[model samples]
Target: MSLDSTLHEALTALNQGRYKTVLKVAKSGMKRYKSHPAFPNFAGIALSSQGKHRDAAGYFKKALGLDPTFHDARRNLAQALILLQQSDTALTLLNRLLEGAPKDPDGWYLKGQALLNCGQPRAAADAATRSLELNTRQPRALNLRGVARNMLGDEAEAIADFQTALTLNPNDVEALVNISLPLARQTRHAEALEAAERAVHLAPTHLNARLRLAMQLLESGDQDGARDQFQTILGQAPGHAQAIEQLAALNAAAANADLEPIARRALKTAPRQSSDAARLHFALARMARQAGEQEKFASHLTQANGALAHIMPFDSDGDSQQFESLRTRFNAGADQVQAPAPSGPTPIYVLGLPRSGTTLTETLLGAHPNVCPLGERAVPGVLLAPFLENDIAFDTAACAQFVARDQERLPALPDGIRFYIDKMPENYRLIGALLTAYPHARIVHMCRDPRDVALSMWQAHFSGKALSYTYDLAAMAHRFNLYAGLMAHWHSVFPGQILDVQYEDLVTDVDGQSRRLADHIGLKWVEDMAHPERSTGPVLTLSANQVRQPVHSRSVGSWKPYETMLTPFISGLDPNLWPGVQQG
Candidate 1:
């Protein structure tokens, strides 16, 4: 065949999603038209579509070698490198490409992907934005920007991007999966579940789609469905890192020793510094802990934290500086608020540090017939953004607007629900604005032993960048110190408006604490409030499985087991925040 016909055939096959046909055409075309770079580039694309990134990289390199000016081939090579987890090398190539062709939208998008792979979400977001500015019609660029935005905790903007991408391509599985979590976090469980379900339907065997569907199922309180999804993934790919880890976590307390071997085997092949290895190692650690293998647990836990830290590094100094700024501004009443909304469901703000009993407290409140627990909604931060950016006071009119916006943002409330709970742990940062905006808002400050909180956070696997401080011992301690200082400031400023609930005290004396919580939140204490295990509210936190069971003292002093190993975390914590625990 002539070169023109050969190139046309390969390009047509590629555009039609006939990857296998594209490979066949490319192979035949390359044999006759060896001088053409397009043949090798098409072959590389086919290989990449078939999940053969290493093979794709070889073809792409050959294409670039045949024609040094083949920008398409260079971009494809970088994309393959990204898929192969060689992000640093990919970034280098993408940088060189962008420098030469600064107006290339594809180059910017690939650079964003490379930056995202390198854990530079902020930079990735900027690169993605540049691509979109150059070409607004690219759904992939919009989706890429959404992923980066989600990582940077810009859920509202991320969702907007995802929605726009879906408008462009309704069957975009990546956008569907990416948007689900933020929607779920916003308490729009139905929408989240719909997106996840559609992704899985569109790509049944896609690992990420299945994993996301399972997570959405878990978030929507469909444990059985979630378990089925995880089991399906494991059945298809036994060595799937996230599937093994999640399934193990779902059944950890039941002594799911069956998964320990799979996780152990997967860990051997996963890269030492990758998130996959961290998850597998954490799974094994959980299994070891369950089997009473203390030393084994400690060893795996240490390795997991080490691996995770490589991917999720926290800027302790930067975080501290920001905290200092927030404390100073809030202390000076920089964003003072107006009175609470006159008529609406009373807002209950459950704020604290991660793993500080926020979930358990929310569970207890959710059990109340009149309280609707909007599980960990990110609305407070969104509502506080305007005032936080400016040095303006939120007067009564502004407060009314704030309340109106919050109510509109919230999911449709069920009939007879009088108190809507926002149990985001980080809501502690917005206490001042939250109180001012919602005058009748009740604050429940959940406090736990700093040592235990630090340990729990270290062992936990968070989804996004919001909880990245938990990946390191020192970072966790630093976050705790900042959180403590901020909470102290809020307590002094809003005296008697906040109710302090110690986790240990609550777990030990469930009845008394339940009464205190109900009264403080303006609810009548009932027997149902004591039975949180029976409450079917959404449990999207890391403690999802643990919270479904009866409240127990098992996790109260969990830090004691690794007391020696947690010296770094303990040493970094404030002495005054140690509670009843004796610090050596």
Candidate 2:
């Protein structure tokens, strides 16, 4: 056969998914036409199909060197680069492809995927939108856009996009898997589980689908199911670092000795300063702590946090400036904006630093027949964004606009529900705006010991960039100080409108504190409020595992074990804010 016929045979084999056959034919063609780009490109495609991304990238590079304008080779090379986690290079190549062929929807779609992997979700969304503009029926673009939207904290819109992508191509495993995230975020766990299960069923061997299902199971409190799923993933791909790390975490509380080897292996293979290494180290730290190896625990914790700090560096100065601006704007408008009379079912705002019993309080309240719990919704931030944009002076008009916008976005409350809880911990920063908009809305400010709060924040790994300050001890302390100052300001302005619920007190005196919380929210005391562990709804926060168990005082002074390492955080805190606590 001629060289062209041989290349054609390789392309046919590739299209048929006979990757080995494609490779065999491509190698023969390459020996005959040694300098031809098509043969190398064919081999690259086969290697990529076989999951040898690094090897595929080298072949693709050779193809591009032989033929600079080979668009197919260039696209394949970019894909291999992305698969190798070299999104920066993939992005550069995709940009060149788009520059040469501006109408290429695939190029735009690939660019969107690259941008999303690079942590530029906003840019990814824009790129996905551009791709859809060129090819409206593109399911991949819709799915990519949905992922970007979810990352941007727009779960509702993200769900819509995912649904559209599924409609366009029901077999799209990524869409099926990704739709579960926003569904889970919305507290629709059953639907999320169903979506994840469907994704796994559709593509049983797909690592992402299995991982998504495992995560959903874990979040739904099905630890055994999640463990089985993670174990299966590891069995299929022993070097699956994420699965190994997650298994370590799942078993960390129990100090499962079997996980130690897996954790060590994952840590050994994971890239330095990568999130996977951080997760494995944190898991090892937990296991050590559980086993009472305090010295080893401290060492592992330090190493884990060091890895996280390197990967997700906190911008202390920028964060301080942002917090200062929030304080300045809210303080400036405190006198100018008249508090509106609260009407309708009053919103119960659960405001506090993360891991400070906000989830517990909300879960307890949500168990009541009269209250609905909306777990950590982004509506408050969305409503307040307009007021905070461009240093705009917040006034009565801004307050009214915020209230109107928030009311429109508010989800429908259950029948006979007296109040709904918005349990977004970060809403503490928006207490001034919240009270200004809804004067009658009950505010529950959950406070914990600063040391414990800082320690918990440091130990935990948050999913998004929103809590980057938590990675550093000093930054966490600084953010905590800002929170305390803002809460004090809110107290001065709102007076009796805000209720302070101490986490330590709540856990120690469950019944008494529960009654106080009930009275503050204008609800009659119910036995269910005292037993939040029995709550039916999903606890979506990092406190998911904690709230599922009975309230205990075990976590009250957890920082004591690591006190020596937290000197900077404790010393940096405002002593007055933590009454009775001595500064280091």
Candidate 3:
């Protein structure tokens, strides 16, 4: 057939959804028209339509080689590269494309997807925004923007974007799966789980959708459901590292048959610095700890944290500057903001370093009849961000604005609820602002042994960049020192306003400390408060499993087992923070 007739036939077949006929025509044409880029490009489209990205990439590359300036072939090549998980290369091609066609919304959207894949969420979000600005009706762009925003810690904006995308296409599984994260971050686990379930329902064969559903199930305290979902994933993709890691965590205590071995084998092949490696190592570390293989535990923990270091390295200078900024703002106790009295439930701010018993404390408080636990709300951090970022005076006027906004941000509390808890451990940083905004609010500071806190933080896998410092022992110690200094400042500045609950003391004498905490917060001591394990509410924090059991002192000296591996943390800590451990 003549080249014109061949090209016309191939185009017609491609446009008619006859991918096989298009491919056959393209392959036949490629031999006769060796210089024609269209033949190879057509073959690539057909192959990519059939989900053969690797072969599609080769054909697209050949097409690009034939005609380097062919924009259509270049765009197709970039997309194939992205699908083949070569996002860095895709990004380079996309940057060149966007430079030539600056107004191309599709180019911006592709760049956004590539950036998101490459872990550049800020850049990805910008790209998505540019794309959306150019073409507001693109649901995929909105979905991409939501994913990026979620990664950048803008959960509210991310959810809004996802909701907008869903409104555009209710069957968008990608939007449904992506929305679960920010929803879960806001402690709306049920909604998150529902979103995940819908995604899995829409795309039953999508591994990521099922994986997310499994995670949501686990977080929602449906362990059996999570295990089944994970098992289902493994049945299809046996080498899935995330599934192996999560299943390992579920079966760690029981030491399920061959489960540890399976996890160990997966860990051997996973990329050294990937989150998968971190998760697998953490799971193995737990297994080692459970089996009393302390040395193995130390090794796995070290590797786990090392992997996280590559992904989210701590910023010591930034953390110190933040501490200094907070000190400068609240050291002298700013004039109390004269905002109107809050008519809602008085907030009980549970503040401390992560893994310093904040979850346990919150659980105890939540057991109270009048106290509703709103787990780890980002209200304070969000409120403090503008002031900190812009260097605005957090004076009486700013404080009044903060108080009014704080009230506005909170969900409506049910009637008869006397106190609600916001137990984000890092809220300790904003205690001054929190009190300034709500003078009637109660502050409970959880104090744990610095060694235990450091070790625990190192072991825990936090969801976002907010606690990235936990990956580095020295960074955790530095933050701990800052926490120490800040707590002392709060005590001096607001004498008798904040209650210090020693985690060790609380665990050892649950009854006594529980009453003390209840009294300090003006809560009537209830027998239920002493036994938080009886409460069947969702425990979404890292200490989820431990909190569901009766409070115990086993974790008190937990650092002793890994004392030899904790040199970096030990060296950076203030001696006063080390309660009873002998420092070398």
Q: Among these predicted structures, which one has the highest TM-score?
A: 2
Q: Model 1, which residues run further than 4 Å from truth?
A: 5-36, 54-71, 74-78, 81-203, 220-222, 252-255, 332-343, 382-408, 576-580
What lDDT does candidate 1 reach at residue 274?
A: 86
Candidate 3 structure lDDT: 0.84
2 versus 3: better lDDT goes to: 3
Per-residue accuracy of model 3 over 113-153 as CA lDDT, tens digit each: 99988878888999999999999999999998998876655
In model 2, the runs with Cα more than 4 Å from the true position are 1-3, 21-36, 62-68, 239-255, 332-335, 338-345, 382-389, 393-412, 576-580
TM-score of each: 0.83, 0.90, 0.86
Instruction: Give the C-alpha miss distance for residue 24 in model 1, angstroms.
Output: 7.9
Q: Name the 10 consecutive residues with the lowest summed lDDT in model 1.
A: 331-340
Q: Which residue pairs does candidate 2 place in steric collision?
A: none
Q: How close is candidate 1 to the true structure, as a TM-score?
A: 0.83
In model 3, the clashing pairs are none
What would the TM-score be for candidate 2 when compared with the true structure? 0.90
Judge candidate 1 at residue 533 and give its lDDT. 83
Provide the clash count, candidate 1. 1
Off by over 4 Å in 3: 1-102, 114-130, 133-137, 148-160, 181-191, 252-254, 333-343, 400-408, 576-584
lDDT of each: 0.84, 0.84, 0.84
Query: Considering summed lDDT, which 10 consecutive residues are worst modelled in model 2?
Result: 330-339
